[model samples]
Target: PLTVLQGYLEMMQEQVLEGATREKALHTMREQTQRMEGLVKQLLTLSRIEAAPALAMNDRIDVPMMLRVVEREAQTLSQEKQTLIFTVDEQLKVLGNEEQLRSAISNLVYNAVNHTSPGTEIRVSWQRTPQGALFSVEDNGPGIAP
Candidate 1:
């Protein structure tokens, strides 16, 4: 991430400041900066989750409702280039911190939006399992090769 930020700063300095593709360079810089900001926030949340070992994990969270919130938020962040879908069992629930769960799902959606190209489809699903529940993220990106 630092490497990407440095490269973008260099590009902005060399290209935009030099009067070459000024508009495009500035747009790219803004986008990159926003992306970096989101990544940093995610890192911070993860750090807090790790360092603070006593997070109140007793709140009963409705999985389907939380997914709807994530989907709504992701739609705004998705740049209208990708599709978001939900496949949730209406009865699915979990006992966990709501904020952390939302953060985790939001992170997954944000990652799919940034990793996949335009027009890709991202599916966030939750389903009931015999043991508990299952939540999964699916994206139509060029998946990693074996």
Candidate 2:
């Protein structure tokens, strides 16, 4: 994608030098640049998540609060077209690294947002299992193929 963006920039620069319409060239260049930036940001985020320890002991995190955060982030990604619904039992807490948990849940929510269509609903829920808490994001989108 970066390579494609670079190619697009080069083409736009050539077009500008050739006296092509400035408005069209600039608009195309700006869109390509924005797409390139978004890809770079997602790559950096993935790298940071991978470099961190998978499991770390730290402060206790409120499951409900974490769910809220995930829901908010998902809603932002949905661009106001999709709605995120979160359901969590009261007094649910977990002992883990807050950042890691947040990242994991956010990733799940992000995936749901990407896979679902606009106006689709994302349902996030948490339950206290015997061993630990189970977090899930369900979407009213196409399910996995059989």
Best by TM-score: 1
Superposing every Cα of model 1 onto the true structure, what RMSD results?
Answer: 3.3
How many collisions per candidate?
0, 0
Model 1 TM-score, 2 decimals: 0.78
- The local lDDT score (0 to 100) that residue 111 gets in candidate 1 is 77
**What's the TM-score of every candidate structure?**
0.78, 0.69
Go through the candidates in order and give each one's C-alpha lDDT. 0.79, 0.76
Q: Please, what are the lDDT tens digits per residue for candidate 2 over residues 29-59?
A: 7777877776688788889878866666768
**Runs off by more than 4 Å, candidate 1:** 1-20, 142-146
- Sequence-dependent TM-score of model 2: 0.69
Evaluate residue 10 in candidate 2 and report its C-alpha lDDT on the 0 to 100 scale: 82
Candidate 1 structure lDDT: 0.79
